[model samples]
Structure formats: C-alpha cells, structure tokens
Target: MGKAKKFRGLKFKYKVDGINKQLTDKYQTIEEFLEAEFPKNNNPLSPTGDTKIYDVTWNTHKVSINKIVNTLSDLRKVLSVDCYVTNTDIRLEKIKPRELERKSTYSIEQIRELTKEVLFEEDKRNAKVELDGDIIKGNSQRYQTFFTKGIKCVCCGIEGKYFAKEKVYRDKSYHLNLYAVDENGKEVLMTKDHILPKSKGGQDHIDNYQTMCVNCNVAKGNNLED
Candidate 1:
C-alpha cells in the first residue's frame, strides 16, 4: 500500500462522560439500570407512552434511545459489566448502515392473491357503494389491499403499513376504519383513484382504478395525468 487513507468529513464524536456518570451513579450494574429504565407499566418506550426522552444531554447528543440500548447490548456481548464500566473512553461507531425503509419481501403473485382475497371479503360483507350519476364510488376495499400488503405510493413511491381496526369517530359514533402508517409515522388513509377522473367522463371500472394515498390524491385534485 502506497499510503494509509485518512478519514475526512464532518466527524461526529459523542462524549460519554455525562451519560456514563448518569447511568453508573443511578444503578450499581448495567442490568439494574436497564431494568429500571425499561419497566413494563408506564414505560416511555412503549407504544402508548411518550417515546421521547426530555434529557438536555441526550437531546444535544442527537442519539436515539434505541441506539443507546443497542450500544450497551453490543458492549455486553464481548466485555464484562465491570470492564465496560471501567472503560470510560467507550465510543459508538456504525459498522454497517441500516435500511431506511422496511419493505415487504412478498412476490408479485402473492400480492395479487392477497388483493383478490380482500376484494372477495368486501363483496361477502356487501360493502357500501355511493352512486354519483353513472359513476359508482366507494370501493375502499380495492385500495385497502395496498395498505394490507404494504404497497408503495404511485406518486411519492413511499411504502405504507396497514394499521388495522382503527376506531374513527364519525356522525357522533365510533366506526372502525383501515388506515396505513407511512415512513414518517403519519397515519395515511388509502384511496382508490380513477386513472381518468369521473369529472372528465371517466367510467367507474376496475381497469381505471389505481391506489393512492389521501395526501397525494388531494394534491392531484381534478388535474388529468398524461
């Protein structure tokens, strides 16, 4: 080798002094600290509880709770608790980057079958449909299939996850509705868009239907696509 490569760029080095003291002083062992921090009832990390930590150091450090847990777990893998506690100059480094989006590994045929199953179920329940002149609307089940299978958006190409049996308050009553959770953790209502809008004399047919997120569909409005 001619020369050793020098690392260059905005390097992020986190000082563990404050966090180490906070963790070490609170509990004698790491196991004790973890147990107290992640309790079953009223836990911050739980779905119902507040996920965010209001610590000044943690906020400034720009590290997630999951990252901290993973770092400690990794340390426990090789070094003993005493060794890790004594090693005050411990550094967290990214050995491998994680994928941004969790995609479904389902095949094309599998997706088709899943979609068909949803449609069949909707038909069995006699799903309500709204008739507007010659245009029959409200085939929500068709679009719900995309959410059920975690399909990507046609416009933004963002993947969505099905959040089943969400209670919706409508007309002074609660009704369960199908919703999809997007990459940003936002709840998205899936909709079936007509390729050719009904306003432009588009027929209400299966061939003309396409799945779209509520946001994208609202943005598209009555604008015809080429």
Candidate 2:
C-alpha cells in the first residue's frame, strides 16, 4: 500500500483497482482541488449571506469546516488566490485594499498612560504573580521587565514602539498597537512569545517569556529551539 497524500496537514487516501494512489497528484493547485471537491452549486445560500452552511467532504471522508478554512488561509499566503470563508462556503474574490493612514507614534511613557486607561482593568484580571510563594493578582513581572529594558524582539533585535488608534465602531474603543521598526524602517507588529511554548508544558511565568516580532513568532509556531 502507498503512503496517503497530505494537503495542508489533511490526509487524502484513495483506492483504485485494489491499489492505493495519491489524490494530491491529480490537482495542479489548491484552487483547482477546492473547486473540484467543493463545487459552487453545492452552496445554495448567496455568497453575501451571513449564514451559509454545507457539509464539507472529500470522497467518503468528512472534512471539518475549520480544517477547510485553515487550508484555504494557508494557500492564500503562498498563492495569488484571494478568498474568504462564509460559513462553509469558500468565496473567491478580489479583496479591496484598505487605504493606509499615518498612525501617531507614542513614547513609552504615553503608551504606559494609554494602556492604564484602556487595558488596565483587563490586564489586572488576567495577569498574576507569585508574592512570597503565594500566587497573587498583579501585572506580569516579565512584561514589567520588558518595559523597563525597552520592548524589543529577542530574535531580530528590533525595538518596539507603541501606538493607539480609536475604533470606528458604534461603541468606540482604543486599539493598542505594538510595532517594531525593521531595517528598512517598515513597521511590523510585535508579540509576546513563550521561550518554551505553553503547549510544551512551559509555564506562563516571568522566566518563560520573550518579546518577538509577529513574523518570527508565526514561523516559530510551537517549535522548541535546539
């Protein structure tokens, strides 16, 4: 028996005349495979509709909606295909780019002030610390250390700057942005990463934390350094 075919982590196996064949070889691209497996007519609801549900399947195997969406999203990053999942229906369309607006940069002091006003309550509830061997509610000591040492990506060594933008929705709220400037002076979002990922049994304590740029963190995923 031949090995099963894998597509974006999903396995597809097929048998023909008592012989197993790779199903992935039949399709030229992910877009082709998607169109062939999930035809447009299978979706009765309009593309614009809020609720459009379909039983996603490939041959006799039932595929989860999340798997399909994740596959499509992964493909979009590599391929030129622009698409969005509305429920189970994958709608292929040219996404209009939003206009770029010049965002105001804030000093570390200003950022501290804004964070206190916007996210202080939420952070206070979520953040915890161990005081004299007793776990207590407080801001993360690691975060405090990072702030004091200046926020910077440990991997790339890019210093992070803070910004806050007002939300446009009815209930207006502030959106805090933590961005790092690259060599080319381009701004990239900064993130807090686990030195040893939480999935690998790493604790959410001060010692296990590090600052990372979004791209580096995504590339790292759940991987541990050798």
Candidate 3:
C-alpha cells in the first residue's frame, strides 16, 4: 500500500501576495489578518505563537484542505492568496513551473474559472486609480526591477520619475523635482549621453552612457567632460 498520508486529513498550503498596501494595511499584522479571515478553531499558528505548527515558513500557512475549499474561495481571490492541496502524491518539484498553480487534481474547467475570477478582480482594482500631476499613480507595482539594482540618475541622484514629485512637491504638490526643472520652473527633458564622445572612438554602448537632462546634454554636446 502507498505510504500513509503525512496529514490525517487533507491539507492546504497558502501564501498571500504582497502588492497593494491599502488592502493589506486594513489588517495591522499578518497574524491578525489570518485570525480574522480564517475560522477560530483552525488557528494557523501554534498557541504560544513562537512557532507555526502548520506553516513551513513565516509567510506560508497550512489548513485542512476541506475547510479552505468549502469556505475561503472568495477571500482567497480577493487577497490574491495562492493556495494548493498539500497532501497530494504529486509535488511542485515534479511539474514544470506555472505562473499560477491550481490545487492538485482540480479540473481544467475549475482552473479556468478561478483564473477568470482573479483576472476580473485585478482589472476591477486597476480601474480605480487617481493621477497625481505627471505621475499616473495606481495600485499596480512598477519600477521594481530597476529599484532592485538601485538605478538612479548619476547626475541629479533622482531615483525615478515617481521619486521626482515626492522629492520636490511643495505647498500642496508639484509636478517636477528640483533636479528635473530649471530656475524658471520649466520642465527639463532628459536623455542618455556618452561620457566619452562617440566621435572620439568611445564605443557606442551602455558602458559609455550617462544620464543627463536635456539642458545639460545639449550644453555638453560632443565634449568629453562637463
């Protein structure tokens, strides 16, 4: 016979996606959030709370699969929680990676329905947005890749287009950062320029490039140094 199930009953593993802060901020902490959302009897963590009896990591929580499938479908989609049946013979390591994985043994129809629901909720959230000046602010996460690398303008030290307004907004709010505008408060266009002149045999590549505002780029055109 197959080895006895690790869990006596069906088990589910879950992790919440951290993206929209407004939705997450509604709950002060992760523990509070889970307690309020899940049944009181299922206490995701141990009584002492120092260690998780069911969770593999701080973020991953475990529950009886029946309880979640019966009750938490709507909540899971709203919170963007990724959950899967954990007592299955198959494992994630056995399958190719998926952008989003459905519960093991779920039908293709079920997966499609769940995927549609998630997409609908995301589109609904994205529809609600407010612009701040030149910035098209929204719940969507962007600039994450560059941020990981600490990309910033070498000249003005401006981190990003969004960072510009946050740094220079005065009174109520302004559109441009101090470094992005001139003395007259006019917007300064920006571009990539060569630190060593291309005509002077500097290879045309990113290694030779530097960030420069339009005014600075034009003023220093064809010259090796500022």
Candidate 4:
C-alpha cells in the first residue's frame, strides 16, 4: 500500500543493501547501490533493475540498523506474493478480482470506490448553515481549582521542575503572564484547564484536573498518543 520495491536477484542491476554495497565499494563494479524498497512519493529508485530511486515511508532514524535488516528479512518471506519491487516504485498486489468474485468476503476495492463516491457528494452535504450569539464565560473555572483543591501530580509531589504537584497543574512558568484589569473592570487573564490528560486515563470528568494559562495545559494535548 505504500511504495513499490523490487525483489533482489530478479533484477540483476538492483542491489540489496549489504550484498550490493561490497561490490560497489570494494571493486567499484557499480557506480552506486540501487536502493530497492517500497516506493513512496519521495524516492525514485525502482526495483526493475533500473537505477531510479524512490522514497518509502519507513523512516531510517526511528528504526535501528539491525532492526532494518531484520524487517527486510521478514519481508523477504512474503515479498513475491504480497509485493513487487519495481524499477520506479514498490508495487503491492491486491487480491485477485476473480477470487473476489467467488469469495464471501468484502472486496478490497469496495472502500476505495465508496470513498470516491462520498467525495463527489461532499458539496451537496455542505449546503448551508447559520449560527447566533457568542458564548464566552466559564473558560478558566476548573483550571483554577487544582491549586484551589491543593492536589498535586500523583507521580511527583509539587517540589520542583516537575511542578505539577506544588501547583496542582502543569506550567513552564519560567515566563509568567501579567494581567492588568480592563477598563470594563474585567481581568484580561484567560487560561485553560487540562482535562483527563495523557498521563492519566484522560477521562473528561470533573475528577480530571483543569489547567489554566492557555500555554500551561495545552502542552499535554493528545500527544500522549505518541
């Protein structure tokens, strides 16, 4: 589904990583190693034994060098039936149409065709809309409560840099925001509360702490998913 890759040895010119590198580096038999991996939009290398290279979604940094080799060995197990290393990109094969016609399972292309049809009708669903009045008031109520309730982070008590416990909320208050009273007698200080956070189960109940200071609470957005 990502990019086209070539099967080694099927194409004489295309080279596997270590296997081809020795030839190119030691004997200078080839100018460079032909990168053969799944073709993503970024790479130009092809598996057809041609010299073109291509980009694949696999990020080299996130995976260790040994892990990369291990993954390649794993892929080699099913490379022939599941994927094709191409000269321009890796081409993966879908289930055969004849097999789909005879099977009870949903066809592989059904989602693709449905997505196309939905996209075509998107404008009809976007017909029209209207709204009235603006609501802005109870913005920072819960955030201010953490310090009010005197609760601290469960892991580390409020003593230092992991200051959630001392403050009962998260803040990189190395920089503090100053608030001056407005002409209308309103305090212009606006902050948010962090709800059930990534550190916790992330429940949205009142049990969840609110963080004030837009910058303070948002530092822990859904990023916990990472």
Candidate 5:
C-alpha cells in the first residue's frame, strides 16, 4: 500500500585515543610502554581475525570533533546522505541521529500479519452481497479461488505460492499470470489488474483480469478504498 521502507545511515568515527610521550621516558618492559601508548584496541571484527589496536601517533594528535563532523559532512554531501550542522547537543551540538536507522510502514511481525490481513480486510468489511433469498451465488466457487488459482500478491507483482492460506483471499480477483500448454512446451499471457474494482460495483466473479504493476497499484490505492 505504501513505498517500501528506507534505511537512513548515520556514521562517523571517534578517536577513542590519548597522548604519548614514550620517547622522552624509556621503559624496560615493552608491554608497559605499549599499554601506556595505546590503551584501547581490543575490538575484533571476528573471533578468528587479527585484532587491531589504536595508538596515539596514528594521526597528527589533532583529530577534532569539528574535523570528524566536517569529514562526515563531506561524505554526506557526496553520497547524498542526510547531514546537519548540529543536533540536540548538550550545548546544542551533542545530540545526533543514531548511526543507522530503518523506517517501515509495518513491522516484520505486522508484515507477517498483514500478508493475509491486507487481502482479507476487504471481504470482512460490512459491504453487502447481492443474492437470492437463502441462496448466495458464487461464494462456493469464488471462496476457493486460492485452490483454483494460487497464492501471490494481488497488489504488488511479486508472485509465488507462499501465502499462508490458499482459500482466504481468492474473491479479490487476485493478481496472476495466464498460462496454457503449447505445441511443444507452453505459452503464458501476462496476468493483469482489474480495470474496474469489485468494491466499486465491479463483478467479483469476473472472467478477465488485467495485470497491474507495483507503481500503478500503489498509485490506484483506495479507488474503491483499494
């Protein structure tokens, strides 16, 4: 129903370092001198990989906050990522967006829930069905559209029989491909979206379907409150 969620990445490196005057003061044990010069470097990307530690002399000993921000800002300008001069800092410069963020129209679990919910939501609405007294037409045949057709996104073009249920959303004139066996192998006509929506007095038991692309489907959202 909405565009796929996007990820916003915010990243920059901090020094996490200190000063070194080891040349002026000599130490007998190399371990003592090394510990004092490079106090923190225990981070390991993988357990089996070589560990790298940071040392004071790695830079000009003048890596400023402003400099790091400027570097990150330059990268943001080049890569077209979001950047800013300041956030909710303690002194109006400390707060910043988290290093990485992802936005979603639905959560993973909600998506799983909506996989079926979006399709079924229409059928459950208080919309009335035309019928003869004590006799409902096509419910029996159309209720079983899943078994008749197959599970796929009736909205987006992504297709597969991976839907959780087969029968539930069949009445929607679901999106699909039309196929037939040919002289040797087979022939397939691309499936299509409905030019008319069933909710807008269109036939639920239609004999023809029109393939709708993702952009078109989304663009046509809620024409029948689609």
Candidate 6:
C-alpha cells in the first residue's frame, strides 16, 4: 500500500519583484501572508509557526532559483504581483495506520494477510527434500570423461587446446577430438567420430566413443554405407 503524505512546519522567505500596493496592504511580510492564509492547526502548517532568516543566493549564475522560490514568485505574478519566496524547511507528517473506504473492499492488512496465507498453502503442495546443509557426493558422467581425467585422445599423443565439431555426421550430437601442431607449434584440435552410427542405435557411451582427425572423419562419412 502507498503512503499518504501530510506536510508541516514549513519556513518560507519571500521577496517581491516589483511593488504592489493591494498585496502589500493585505500582508506586510511574506511570513505574515503565509500565516494568515494557512492558519495554525486549521491548515497543513504547524501550530508553533517557527521561522528564521538566512541568505541562500550564493550561486545565481550556475542554475535558476529553487522551484519553491520560483513557484511563489509565479503565483503572485499570475495576479500581476511579482514576488520571490521560498520555504526552507518542511516536515513530513508521520504515517498512521489508515483504512481507505469504498464501502465495498477489504482493508490493506486483511488483503496482505490473506495473500500470504494463500501463498503458504500453495508452497506446501511442492516436493520437500531433507537438507542437512552438507555437500553430498555423487558420480556425475561429466567427471568421468578424458577431459576430467587428464587423458589425451587415444589416436592423438597430445591433447589439443581446442575441440572441433564434425558437421558431416548429419547432426551435432557429439564432438570428436584430434590433435595437430600449427606452424606456431600450438596443439590444434581434430574432429571426434563415433565408431558406429548413432542413428543406427550406436551408443555415445565411453566404450563406443573414438577420436578421429577431421580429414579421417569426413573420409569415413563418405565411405560408410547408409
């Protein structure tokens, strides 16, 4: 729920751009005018009517005067009166528990509590697992690979720094790794191939996996019968 604001204890300073006898006669000072227009306790102004004098015109060159000062000037300007006034300090009224009335709907707290109860009831339907806050050990296939075991490809003596994909396999089901040295003497990758066709119900499991250079894999792809 959004909070409603009540302003109080505002201190204002005012100056007129030009003299106007009609406004001057009604209120001699800006403070007096504000006090009369917004009486204590009756309006948003504080009952104490605290005020102080201070100079705020330090940087007139950089930016225009504060909005509060300009707004006061504009209000009087509309009535052919030119004035510069600013409220220095304003206190926000403390928020109290309030109920908005429409003569139909529930209060804010009632809606909030009901929403929380519904969410909790929905959460109870989810599966619950016992967590002792300790890391549990499990055998993941990712950890059993040559990449994890620090083993080089069976066909290539050196493990390449990159892995190349064989496109002739009809789909990118797996990657084959071969090794070669570039002119810079850096280990380069070759394509890995499945000894049996995966489309022919061949397993990508460990025992069936084989590494082949790109050239060999492409040659095999052309020679193998459909």
| Shift of residue 160 alpha carbon in model 4, Å | 23
Task: Please report the TM-score between candidate 1 and the true structure.
Answer: 0.34
* Model 6: residue 107 alpha-carbon error in angstroms: 63
lDDT of each: 0.39, 0.44, 0.33, 0.26, 0.28, 0.32
Give one digit per residue, the lDDT tens place, for model 2 in 112-208. 6433332223445454433233333334333343554458888878877764332223212223446777778887866667787765677655567
Mind giving the per-residue lDDT tens digits that candidate 3 earns over 119-215? Answer: 2234535533322322222211222112222334456654333233232111232222212445576645445566676556665445566666655
lDDT of 1 by residue, 34-63 (tens): 344445454323323423322211111222
Which candidate has the highest TM-score of all?
2
Please give the clash total of every predicted structure, in order: 0, 0, 0, 33, 9, 4
- The digit string of per-residue lDDT tens for model 6 on 139-171 reads 212212333333344454444443222222222
By lDDT, highest first, what's the ranking? Answer: 2, 1, 3, 6, 5, 4
Any idea how many clashes model 3 has? Answer: 0
> Which number leads on lDDT?
2
Q: Candidate 3: RMSD over Cα atoms?
A: 21.8
The residue ranges of model 3 lying beyond 4 angstroms of the native Cα positions read 1-179, 223-226
- Lowest lDDT sum, 10 consecutive residues, model 2, at 44-53
**Candidate 4 structure quality by residue, lDDT tens digits, 80-106:** 333233322333333221221111221
Indicate whether candidate 1 or candidate 6 has the larger lDDT. Answer: 1
Model 3: how far residue 110 lies from native, Å = 32
The reply for model 6, stretches above 4 Å from the true place, is: 1-145, 148-158, 162-187, 222-226
As a whole number from 0 to 100, the lDDT of residue 160 in candidate 5 is 30
- Residue-by-residue lDDT tens digits, candidate 5, 39-85: 33453212222322211111112112322232222322222322222
